[model samples]
Target: MNDDLRRAVRQVLPGVRTDLDALVRIPSVSAAPGSVEQVRRSAEMTARLFKDAGAPDVEILDDIEDGLPAVLARYPAPPGQPTVLLYAHHDVQPAGSPGQWSSPPFEPTERDGRLYGRGAADDKAGIAAHLAALRAYSGRPPVGVTVLVEGEEEIGSPNLGTFLARHKDKLDADVIVLADADNLTTGTPCLTTALRGMAACVVELRALEGGVHSGSYGGGVPDALTALCRLLATLHDEQGNVAVEGLATAVPPGAPVSEAGFRAEAGLLEGVQLLGSGSIAERIWAKPAATVLGIDAPPVATASPTLTPVARAKVGLRVAPGDDALKARKALAGHLRHHTPWGLQVTVVEAEVAQPFVIDARGPAFDAARRAYGEAYGNDVVDIGSGGSIPFVAEFADAYPQAAILIASAGADADSRAHGADESLNLADFERACLAETLLLAELTRSG
Candidate 1:
């Protein structure tokens, strides 16, 4: 059956490739204003693919309030078989600057076997892989398939949890497959079981009320920019760990990262020793990491030569699992407010808080996925965790607690440059993922 499924998927690769190209050509960036038309078009394309793959109810479900469209597709299960819900996003992050791309960001260009575009790696390819797997099995897939391709994931999936809560029964499934992730590295089949929580805060520091002449008040007046620099500097101690008080930390249970592997994949230069680590996995996945994202000050090239009155910075706190994002933000904010030098006033506005995700992997669905991946990749499988937080993961967990969740990402590599320029996914990896999904469905139906 696995071999037959593989052959079928191989046969369907050309169609998958064409569909992926067409989807990528649509500028489906949901976060940008005036991008609704493109997002709707992408959702329509996904629905068409679902219909082509034999989904019974492949409809573009649009939110009247949000105006974003989601593809809700369903295929009936044979008697005594269970339903599987496949979740992925049709929306993608904004393609920042065209100058940064090797080719036009919207144009799907294949170079050296890699397909490159804004949404190619992040999610659209995952959707294509799901379509390919479903097409291979003529959409029956040995188990019922209900797919929810969201259009607002890049903007934090604000409506997903609400939608899930409202339509719980409609989305009931025995297993849920989330394809927004990738492997631990090339050639490894990884199941991500944990995700670090995230907290975002914008810290604004003020001093001396307003800007003054640099030469006249340089030494006398307190410069807001200097105060901000000092405050941001204190976010991390000398060893480069977040110094915020009351931030909860935990050690995630999983495979530890090797030094050689980290060094090679992270591209760490010489003389730059990686900071604050027991293990790379611990530092990234379990421990808290703080970053000062953006500071609202003049550019170095456009210096005003004045003592700035206000300096604002956006700070990001990557918290470990089970850590409360709201608590972390409060703690960091309190620390900043109290630690401001010389009575400088500091205001920290809460930007966003996303709770972490941890999936229990001891279940029949996971066992089936392990078997499917092993068969597809011809390798042993490893369970891993991520430091990045997906805001909707916890919501999915809550909405589908009975459903076994599986994370089979195509670019789950440590060096997979997601959210960065030059991000690419291997075509072979994509094919393997599709075959694995097909096998997983077969295994799940057999389990019943």
Candidate 2:
């Protein structure tokens, strides 16, 4: 079986590059118009690969509502074997301002052993990895397999929770292979065990009726922009810690981010002091992170604004895995509403919220992943937590409590630029992930 799988994988290896490049060329940006049709085409292409790999039933379900089409394929369980739900997304983030790219963002190119193109790394490569894994099993994997390829994960998976809830029984599995994350660093297999929850709100304050002459009304009329700025200012203390009274929480011990790594990843300038005191892991995973995403005001180019009547700022709050998004949103809204310096009325618009996810570390699934990665890489898997939230992971965990959810992704290479102008993935790392997936499936089959 191993030899057969190996040969099948090798046969598919040369085509992986071709498949990824072909898909990347489609410009399937889910957020843009005419992109949904491209996304649907990609789904159809993906479904065909699964059918060729050995799936017995493959179907594409279009929007029962406002959702990108989801592709599901089922491979029945071999006697006494366990099923693995393979999850991936087909849609890609808009390749913002393609002019910023070294090459055309849609043209997959290889430089210094890295494939570069929009969606090449962020997730198209992930989709390729899933196809490669299925090819390795030759469609008749040792374990049962069902794939849930979502089309709108980049937009926070607004419709997936409902889809999962409706199809919960059909999707039950012993393990969930969420092939959407990356290793901690290149070649170092990373096992993501936790993700921070996220919630966003825009605080708008209106003090005056409309813009008034700055010189004339500067003293008598309260500046709405000033009041909004003050309200935003109160959100963080002098040292940059979130001063929102009830939002912050304690961080866990694992998933440490060294100061050096943080600086490098965040592109911190020299001589700049790092704000907030705590372990990098704690600061990112277990604690709350607040950011004033954007301010709504006249641009500097359009100067000479009279006393502005209204000003608003979009705020993003990242809560710990245990922090409640709704409660946090309410607390933040109330704080802003109560803390306005002047008598300006405040309006807070709740943008979006996603519950955090914490994978239980002590489980057979974790052990199998550790061992599979160890066998493939000759090293222990590193534990890490993501600051960004993938809501579907939380929803999946909620729906299938018994399943061991594992994220084996190839995202660590700097060359694997996801969401950037030119994104790519390491061919070697992708192959390693495919091998690991194969081993994991075999391990799960034997474990039961």
Candidate 3:
């Protein structure tokens, strides 16, 4: 059966490649203001793939009041077999600019061994991997299968929890596979065992009543933008560590990553020292980190020499695995306000926050998955951590405590450049991912 599955996956690769290209052509940028239609088209495309794969029930679930579309397809389990839930997302981050990419962002192009386009790695290829695995079995697996491809993951899945509650029966399973996240590197099969949660806020500082000429008000009176910059600088200490109090921080459980490899992977310039302390894995995976997402200051092209009266910035903080996201967000706000320079008027409007999670990947289902991926990749599988947050992961854990959740690095690798310009997927790794999932389903059946 394993050989047959391998042959089947090899045979379906061409079709899968074509489908992936076509799917990548759609600009399903969920974060854009006018992207509803594109997101719907992507969801519809995902639904058609599952329907064609012989799913008994395929639905585009858009019933959530303020939610975008999602594809849910199910095939009932055999009498004694446990069900397996497969997950991915059809939506993607916005492609920044046409100039930032070599080829057109919407046109999927193959160069060397990768396919480049928006959503090619972050999640759209995740959808393709699921489709390929389903097709490899001719749409008839050893156990029951359920596929969930959501439309708003890039936007933090605001409505996912409510939708899951309303449609719990359709999604419940014994083993859940989250086919998102990145591997340790290209050609290395890994399962994400820990993910740092995230919190965000928009902070505004007000000083003078109106803008004044820089020369007229140069020396004595401070500008709002300068004060805002000073406040933002206090988030990190001299050594580049997050100085915010009351946030959880700890070293993660993983093998230490080499400094040279880390520098190359992160694309750091020569002689640029890394910030913070400990191994790269520990700093990124377990410790808290903060970033200024965006500022509402005047652009260089439209700038005038004047003291701006008001300045605002959107701040983002990554919560450690064991920390509470809301608490960390509050602490971040507190630090910003406490360190405000010159007693400037400040307002911290809180934004979305998601709790972190750590997976105990030692059960039978996880064992089976690890073995299957090892066999498929010809390398032993390893445990890794992700700095990015997937809000729905916590929601899934709360909804189904007994299920064994598997977070697979199905499409992304170290150099995929996900959520950035010219994002791409390693083609060879993608094929291995399909084979790994195909083996995983059969392995789950035996374990069950």
Model 3 agreement with the true structure over 1-448: per-residue lDDT tens digits: 8999999999988998899998999999888869889999999988998999889899999998878999999988988999999999999888887998999999999998999999898888888888888899899988999999989899999998789889998889999999898887777799998889999989999989999999999787889999999999999888898999998876676756778888987789998989898778889999999999999987889999999899999999999998999999999888888888998899999998888999999889999998899998888888988899998899999999999999997768888999888899999999999999999999988887
- What digit string (tens of lDDT, one per residue) describes model 2 on residues 59-139? 887746867887898988899999989888888889889788888888989887788888887777777777787777767
Per-model TM-score, in order, reads 0.95, 0.94, 0.98
Residue pairs in collision within model 2: 53-139, 54-139, 182-411
Q: Considering every candidate listed, which one attains the maximal lDDT?
A: 3
lDDT of each: 0.82, 0.79, 0.90
Q: What ranges in model 1 sit over 4 Å off? A: 267-270
Residue-level lDDT tens digits of model 1 in 1-448 = 7778889989998998899889888989888888888998899889998998888887787745775888889988888889998888899888887898888888888787677888888888779878988999876678888998888888777777677766777789888888888687677788888888888888888787678899998888889899988888888878888889898878676777888888877778987878785788888888888988788997899888899888899988887887888888788888888788867878878887788877889878888888888988888888888888777678878776787888777543555566766566677788788888888888887676
lDDT of 3 at 297: 86
Higher-lDDT candidate among 2 and 3?
3
Q: Of the candidates numbered 1 and 3, which has the greater lDDT value?
A: 3
Backbone Cα, N, C clashes tallied per candidate? 7, 3, 0
